[model samples]
Target: MNGNESAPRDAAPRVVVGVDGSPSSGAALRWAVQQAGLIGGAVDAVSAWEPPVAYGWNAPVVDTSLDEENARRLFTDELREVLGEECPVQVHPRLVLGNPAAVLLDAAVGAELLVVGSRGRGGFARALLGSVSQQCALHATCPVVIVRAE
Candidate 1:
């Protein structure tokens, strides 16, 4: 198969999709699932969360585990809502603490395709493309698919 193709039929492909618990991200997850099914591949649903930045020299410590738990829940709930039980394609949920683009790029290693929403739940929803999506498109090792909310 060509390098540009999403996956080859002989091998089990992995499609990594970014999830942010947003409508557009939901659409991207659904699209990734469909693509995985078509290619006989698996879906990796990923979400990234980070603690709020502190400016003082002696900054107050925040409970980052809560953010991690929320990220995990977001990934799982999004997958369940999109595919429900007995999904045709296998879905793997992953939550990490880092920038969205960096997390997605790391997840895309050896992945056949990387999928993400054009814009996430961020303030710039009206923008054509979110920073994460744009960065992944430019730097991902594999082909990237930006799913737009309809």
Candidate 2:
């Protein structure tokens, strides 16, 4: 370690947070951003969506673009609600069409951490952890942090 020598540059820890436009997710997003600032890392805000399909003996065809567009809007709104126009640390917004848990798990690969809320828009109202959060906690490659809604 001399004046002319330089230390190796290490990548900062990256955190992946699930955002579903829910109050709990809003809190999670805020928490993730704060954690990222503390760790000198970045935040990946992921939002997942599924096409709408009417349930019946025979379902009618629905326009998937509408669903995707809405997903994108919701993702943007959620990020804005928490991070405002500018985020303190780097924030990567990811909008994917698939199962929420699966999408989150995939995005968390090689990431330093995965963060999710204890509850979201769906699932039983009394469950300690929502399905997506539970799945991510159990299956995410990196350590999972469940942030409860305030």
Candidate 3:
């Protein structure tokens, strides 16, 4: 190794995973970590939230701070539960505000891969793919992996 030629600082790849505090999302988080381990990459766990549309113009004003805090806590708890104490890969939690699919897609703009889970609606065709997962699969800049609950 020549002194003039420095090692690539950004050689390690990045994988983004969407977590929505659902069982399937937990599985997806695990899957993303496993894949990151294999590829020598890091994982970014992203969760999104937005103001409820049902709040009418004349309706009582609601504070979104509480909701954001709860979303952050949920995201942290899910990450901790999924990764446990001996996690091998580096995982970063990202909380954003907006549509889930759009947020995930934006987060994964330059990622090596993006992972998400099916919402797992039972006894129906919608069980196959959730809207977010479907949109990500169709529009993500990088490869998208969809994990389904066993």
Candidate 4:
């Protein structure tokens, strides 16, 4: 299917949201949860992380497997904390390794909507869309929503 194509009308749609433990991402997660409740669907909170690469005459001497694991645990725990037990909908937390934009776009396949925060650590202007948000908006298989922190 094309990137902009919506899901089939008869299917039970899923909502995917990117969360990074930031305030903005937290807002996005909350928004996505509400939207899922309204639509009678479940929410998938995705967190993506990639190890830093060292550039030099080195043979990739850096190991980030443990770091990635810790980050995944932390992100999942934070998401669960933010989405308290009183939340009205089901939330599934996922942690993956890759570029954030690519990961979200891939997850958007067969989803009803892709949600992300407006601004992130990247050097994007706060007044406008951040890089990851813009990328997902442009490339997601379904409609994309950008939630900005209040």
Candidate 1 residue spans exceeding 4 A from truth: 1-11, 54-57
TM-score of 2: 0.87
List TM-scores for all candidates, in order: 0.85, 0.87, 0.84, 0.85
**Tens-digit per-residue lDDT, 42-115, candidate 1:** 98888888877556678766778777777677677777887789888888777778888998998888888999
For every candidate, C-alpha RMSD to the true structure in Å: 5.0, 7.4, 6.5, 4.1
For 6-61, candidate 4 gives per-residue lDDT tens digits of 34667556799999876789899999999998999888788888888777685765
Of 2 and 3, the candidate ranking higher by TM-score: 2
Instruction: Give a tens-digit lDDT track for model 3, residues 1-150.
Output: 221122244757888999988788999999999999999998888888875555677885667888888888878887889889789998877888888898888888778999999873223564578888989999998999999875
Best by lDDT: 2
Best by TM-score: 2
> Which regions of candidate 2 deviate over 4 angstroms?
1-11, 55-60
Backbone clash tally for model 2? 0
Clash count for each candidate, listed in order shown:
0, 0, 0, 0
Q: Quantify all predictions' global Cα lDDT against the true fold.
A: 0.84, 0.85, 0.82, 0.82
